[model samples]
Target: MRPFLFLGVRPEDAPADDEYDAMLRCTGLDESTLRRVRLEAAPLGVVDLDAWSGIVVGGGPFCVSDPEDDKSAVQRRVEADLSRLLDAVVPADKPFFGACYGIGTLGRHQGGVVDRAHPEPVGAVTVELTAAGRADPVLGVAPPRFGAFVGHKESLSVLPAHAVLLASSPTAPVQAFRVGRHVYATQFHPELDADGLATRVEAYRFDGYFDPTEAADVVAAARTSGVRTVPPVLRAFVERHLHPRTDSGSGRGVLRDEIGAAQG
Candidate 1:
């Protein structure tokens, strides 16, 4: 059972502990198996690869598109650190699942353009599988079409040359993608459901997603509409790609939380 390392940066509003608890509930990773890296408070080190089965980066309010002068010192350090990490990961084709902010990090590492061109409102969307996506070894286990929850101010304006787009929505052309073999990313929150997102809406109301006055409406809308059914995608990512790959440089980091439940 390999452990899944969860790297997070938001502390003021979205605490890593709470988010980890929710993810444990969603992904079924136990308490001891998920490690947290508070990238905001500390620098990321290459040694981090020594301890986890795979890496899972969560969403945050950090803006990768901010001007270099406007970028906080912490953000700068994290970006640099992640860049170094991806150098090891991209070549090895490690099993990594990045949501939201992960897209910008991974995209930036690969020389792709990431910005606010394809912003999507916070809510549900119908994800359509491209022909390649339909046959994608990792994503094919998911249904051809299903709704997913997404809220992003920025996206990969142009995918990296070596990247392949997996899932798309009318509003966002690259909802999901793959780099080489095992590296996967989504603009949506695969770890989030309505209940989890409600907590975020309440915490991030004034930050950006919505006006403070509209927080109630946002939560209410989430409750009423519910989350789109795309658990299979998340499950599939964990199962097919994250497990049984022993050749990766980051392989055997935890070996405790290796994903189970294979697709038929």
Candidate 2:
């Protein structure tokens, strides 16, 4: 069986470990089941995309909305790497899913505008699935109005031509989108639950999103905030798509440690 790849770029030692775990826990799949997650450790080289069944990207602190002058060295390098990845993935119309930071990458790759005009604070916001979204087998289990943890300083101001807006919130117009047949991008951190989002609020408090003094308040809101089901979508994606496409004979216990190791 081919393993699904998870790409992340928060510098291995970011202060938001708890938040990362919390967010991923919402994916519902056990770490063992998601056995092929990895980070772009060194160069912005072209990654081998054919080896995996799919790709999942996590959130980061870097801002895609920032101008060229303000973009960090690591951010630029990561963008270049992502560009290469997208060139390969999108052209083939491969299966892909991205959250938060991932949305900006897909939008930029597809020639959409990404900016800070619709930044949402580090709190829970309601997300309503579009008619297409409700009919989608992937999102069928999700409620019509569900809460999500949003702390993005940037979002897709306008969608690319080929993209379909799948979900939205009052604060951000493009909460989620699907490009072509297999690619998907979500503005909110679907990986995060209430507890997981609290870690991010605390870690990212002084950095922005909200007043540094109000970290306590943000934590309170995150704890009580309602959350939606994304893990089921994740499991469905892997089990429904990735599992069936594998070349390997075994499906169940493949690359368990690799999944846990790749996230760090």
Candidate 1: Cα lDDT at 105: 88
Q: Model 2 off-target regions past 4 Å? A: 12-16, 19-24, 28-41, 228-231, 243-264
Candidate 1, residue 243: the lDDT equals 57
Superposed model 1: Cα runs more than 4 Å off: 13-15, 48-50, 241-264
Candidate 1 positional error at 100, Å: 0.5
Best by TM-score: 1
TM-score of each: 0.86, 0.84
Error of 2 at 244 (Å): 5.1
Q: Model 2, range 188-254, lDDT digits (tens) per residue?
A: 8777766666666656667778888888888887766644333245554555464454323222233
Show how many residue pairs clash in every candidate, following the order shown: 10, 4
Q: Residue 95 of candidate 1: its Cα lDDT? A: 76
State each model's C-alpha RMSD to the native: 5.4, 6.9
For candidate 2, give the lDDT of residue 51: 71
Q: In candidate 1, where is summed lDDT lowest over 10 consecutive residues?
A: 255-264
